[model samples]
Target chain A: MVEFTPDEMMTIAASRLLTNDDVCFVGIGAPSAACNVARLTHAPDITLIYESGTLGTAPNVLPLSIGDGELCDTAVTTVSVPEMFRYWLQGGHVTVGFLGAAQIDKFGNLNTTVIGDYHNPKIRLPGGGGAPEIATSAHQVFITSKQALRGMVEAVDFYTSLGHGTGGNDREDTYGVKTKGPTVLITDLAVWKPDPETKEFTVVSIHEGVTRDDLQATCGWSIKYAQDVRETPVPTELELNTLRDLQSRTAIAHSL
Target chain B: MSLQDAVAKYIKDGQLIALEGFTHLIPHAAAHEIIRQGRRDLTAIRMTPDIIYDQMVGMGCIKKLIFSFMGNPGVGLLKRVRDSIEHEYPSAITYEEYSHSAMANAYEAGAAGLPCAIFRGFLGAELAKVNPNIKHVICPFTGEKLAAVPSVQPEVSVIHAQRANKRGEVLIEGIIGVQKEAVLAAQKAIVTVEEIVDDFDDMHPNTCILPHFVVDAICVVPGGAHPSYSHNYYQRDNAAYKEWAAISADRDLFAKWMEDNVMSVGPEVFEGRVAHLRGAK
Candidate 1:
């Protein structure tokens, strides 16, 4: 009984998906936290590459921004932005592109651009940085976001990153996207995996204490559950302590 | 050379300008100089249009913004950017948006003296549809389709670095972003440094050095990249970035902030702002 918040559970679950062999292109925010947590715990050898060009960085405290001096100081190597985007990312060296988005569709397409029309927007969001290329160039993609009806939308206003276009093999067949887009979606309420045949995201495991009603309430689309959905295991003591320690250190470092 | 003279000599109204630094070593002091000089109708370019760009945009200095991402780094939304794009506050501005990859490659292409950059990107994304710059080309070598965009050739490019030698050669260390490419791609380049030393005797082998031939002017402005760290010199002013979220939310407050901090100050003011954060390493 270590107590953990839903956000902590989501981060831990996302971290568990990474392995030592994976070279992850990390987005800032929750994805960065998850990737670093994995390095601190199970996947010690995971290569963490920030878009600012820090490669294999092992920072003790989380960076407030991607190009923090800590990332460069702790990195195995730092390359120029052009070389980073061209030779490393677009060259297909990254195994996973961990991302966070403002809105997601049933097919897992993302929208970080705007909340409404392209010409006129209800809310003009921070547009896609490296996501468009990372989504296609990485071997696979993993998405983490807090669950809400507005975020889990029926359709994205803009496709900032192609996840699985219109379901099925559309990402590969139609767009010639060479990578597996959005294989997993980890949220506060549940763990979702794309269907093998259709590529539509389906809930495979609900987090502890979250019911079908909870999932249905947060999601915009009609809920689809796997036949044998299971409860996600609670966080282990080691995982809890490691995560808390990392977060506290990050808070202190950023506060300065 | 002085920062004021460099900016005054190289920059002009309604010109394409790029002030590039990823998250580190952003040319904040130079940007403030641009604002103070009241340069209007300029086209600003950057991969991540951080706080400096936000300040410029809010002050009605820019007419067009050609960028990839617009935010306050890890803090939150850049409210001024949102205000301009969403409500046309201050003034209506046009946007030429692209992914970070495309913008980086575009700069690379510009540096290499090419017309357009061809890459495998924007496959299923909506950016291809909105940005007319994001075109498509068929690779003659392999018949594979790819995205293409015109090279980013800025009329003037400015960057902040750690140090420079008296010979006017600039040395940039730690997180060497697209500064080199941006400088090469621009018609004119200005570099602001923390200090000038005799030579780079004990520099790291991998450090980027801009030969004096490529650099148009060099100005020594210590702590020029405040709010954004200068690698070994100072830590990032995260509190200022967080405070900006609220300060820029209100139009009048943003105006007042500019008037107090930027409109009335010279480049020398930067050193005082980050005196405590020096020797951060």
Candidate 2:
């Protein structure tokens, strides 16, 4: 019998969404792990960019943060942060932008800023880094997170990064964002994609052993299922092996 | 010159100081010097206030923090910063927040001697609601609304680099954040280098080099960006940061760690590279 942790399954799922030749602006944490997993296995030509000014960074192991020295040592080149945002990101060279959020709405809008009311907040989160620009400028955005009832909310407390901005074509019309906002959201329970017109997320697939009821219990809002909703492929032996190897390397990198 | 002398001379009480390093080559040794000397009423600025800022805030050095994002990086929360902001432990420190793009653009504007930076940002975010400094102005040319922020020129900028020549020209290798803009915008700058060389090999493209005239002082402090990293020199010390999360959570433990590791040690405490990432590259 094959076994895999939800974290590993989530990472493998996220990595599979990426393809070779995609210039990905990698965020730290889960996004970094997923990008490295793709680079090591499937997407070797994936140019990993970081907001820390690293371009085409190929780390031997998953970096602890974007600022890790390994990012610089293995990188093809480094640019200034302003240049990264202006020329590379806003200049529309990035193909995919990977992100994680504290909370996400059905519209795929994200909140990494605050938890409760703005003035009197229950929890003050680490504000947005380069997420707003990345969300708007990247040709496509892929979000990954552990599916929890609190995370998949009806509306994020604060919209830190614009996804579809109330669904429909508001992101393009109102915000003047040129790129498609939040193409897919990979979660532990299932995969979601925005509708072509409304832009509301609908569950397109569920992971092995995860039922629609499980997603319903975990998701904060009443989610809509795709008419063609199907079961996501189970993690292959090779994917599991590659992902585990990458995690081991990451452990060694952090230990050092 | 020593880090102690550099800090004593350049940094002062009630000054807006920016120790700008995104994640690489943070001036940890100089930060420890500021803590050791007990400088007060200082407003420290950075894009991301990591463990070093946590240490300074815990020790009651910084009166305010101007930054974009702050945390322990890969680790969870910055216990000290959260404590200061939430519980007002040691002493509550005020903070002004800005997005990463806004801060970078503000620094760029400051470097260019501009009064403010106007950019296409903060359209639908909640940051504009809280931060009074973030304002919206109508573009004269297009009649579109744009966010504007004042230039972020600091009183002094302190940074770390890979090397410097005897002529005092500093070379910053990998991941040059806003160090260049911060230094140029600052009234004065202090740079600490891993080593001082006679002649820099043909410099790499996109490398940031500060001429001697721009740099107020250059001190050779090997292993300066310890827990953080100096690219090609040493690896980031993750274990220390893990230890810091727990140590910084408790006031007494933080003080003890500082006394044992930072306060007691002099600039000579920095030995050669602890763990070089690129082995003989």
Candidate 3:
């Protein structure tokens, strides 16, 4: 079995954060992969809810999206967008809302908007399908994205998802947004958490061979890192091989 | 007012466009205009890229598609993109199954001019490979990078607004950013409205959504935003959406329907059709 390039790092980090009892709201792509990994590996009993209405889905392969046939295949029950949000996600059935972002800010606010002015802008982007609700209603949000200065900015153009809600994040209290807006942002660089006082994000740890200054300089605002950071453990070869093999096979299947 | 004229007035060939409304909301009238014009080899980017993708693919109007979700909730499979890939149509179909949160982050990242946004998703999961075209971008700041995103600048966008002027100043609410961002990101746009409001002060200035200055074409067609609600105007027809979902497959039937309805109808005639549907109602 071959290992994916990021599988080793991804598996180790994902497994460490997840617990067996956690009910996760799974997205498509990488988020789907991670949730399934947790189910297959450490968190075998983890309850996974997909946006497309699959409740407690246990697919052998990752689904393409919430619409994947695999999600509706034998091992699943059904739900609706409204029901999924109310009963499964906002109903307090889920503990973690796993998401990914296109752009992130120092305050942890995100933007799925355009780069320039509000009207007559430059590019057209996909409007929030369910992000607003997911961001504001999930128990707690766990964000994942590839690390880059362009994405990890000081401010985002629009608040596509209510990650922190302008620092007054009343999500959990007022909206029952299960997650604390965005509790953590896991990337290739390092792990990040919100500052207790400011509610802004602060780098908690850098992966092996990554430096502290490097992480700080990437932000558009004056970034800070957690005081006590620790080194992450290396991933097992078995996990790595499985991830790699899955990716290669998927690539062949999708022809990407 | 003929399909050819409608296509000329509202739709353009080979443009990165936005179809208005929601999953079951807007009918994507302008997208149909594009099909009637026989505009081929186009790239469309949007959320759930359905009606547009399906019609474009079936009609061969779309050469490639970049989208987050492209399927109906429980009506079966991702028929369009999957079928294209499976058949090896020589047409490229890129599927980005990013969660709403993740896609927003990517768009945010692209808008911010940052390389990537950090979030928790299914990391070390199987899709890291299945959709392999997704690349890893190095973080310029931290010297750490993964799947960094580039800014997406759409050339044209077609949307349905509650109200618009002859010049195409649109008005929407709640998630104005969605409309605002699409306007800002694309080079040009077409605004199709149910009503052409006389004054801009009708909806709070802040909620103007998209200004007329950016709009190249402002086609005033009452009830044109069928499928997608025009703010306070109308609500989505769930029955029609169900019908659409059921027939998303059966390419031949859809193509023929397009020829009979959208392709045969004129721009001015859209009004008559909407009135008919309402009259029947």
Give per-candidate clash totals. Answer: 0, 0, 51
Ranking by lDDT: 1, 2, 3
The TM-score obtained by model 2 is 0.95
The RMSD (Cα, Å) of candidate 3 is 16.6
Q: Runs in model 1 with CA error above 4 Å?
A: none
Tens-digit per-residue lDDT, A2-112, candidate 3: 333443565446645767888788766567777776676678888887775667778765543354434545345654343454456545677887876667776556655
The TM-score values for the models, in the order shown, are: 0.99, 0.95, 0.51
Write one digit per residue (lDDT tens) for candidate 2, span A1-256. Answer: 6898878888888999888989999988888888888898888988999998889999887888887777877889888887787778868899999999999999889998878986556787887888877887789999998899889999999988899998899987887677887999999888899988899999998898888789999999988988899888888888889888878988977786
Residues A151-240 of candidate 1 have per-residue lDDT tens digits of 999999999999999999999899988788899999998999999998889999989999999999999999787778999888899888
Instruction: Report the candidate with higher lDDT, 1 versus 3.
Output: 1
User: Candidate 3: lDDT of B133?
Assistant: 39
Query: What local lDDT score does residue B23 receive in model 1, on the 0 to 100 scale?
Result: 95
Off by over 4 Å in 2: B201-206, B272-281
Cα deviation of A147, candidate 3, in Å: 1.7
CAPRI rating of model 3: incorrect
Better of 2 and 3 by lDDT: 2
Weakest 10 consecutive residues, lDDT, candidate 2 chain A?
A118-127
Each model's DockQ? 0.92, 0.64, 0.04
**What DockQ does candidate 2 score?**
0.64
Model 1: TM-score, first chain: 0.99
Clash count, candidate 1: 0
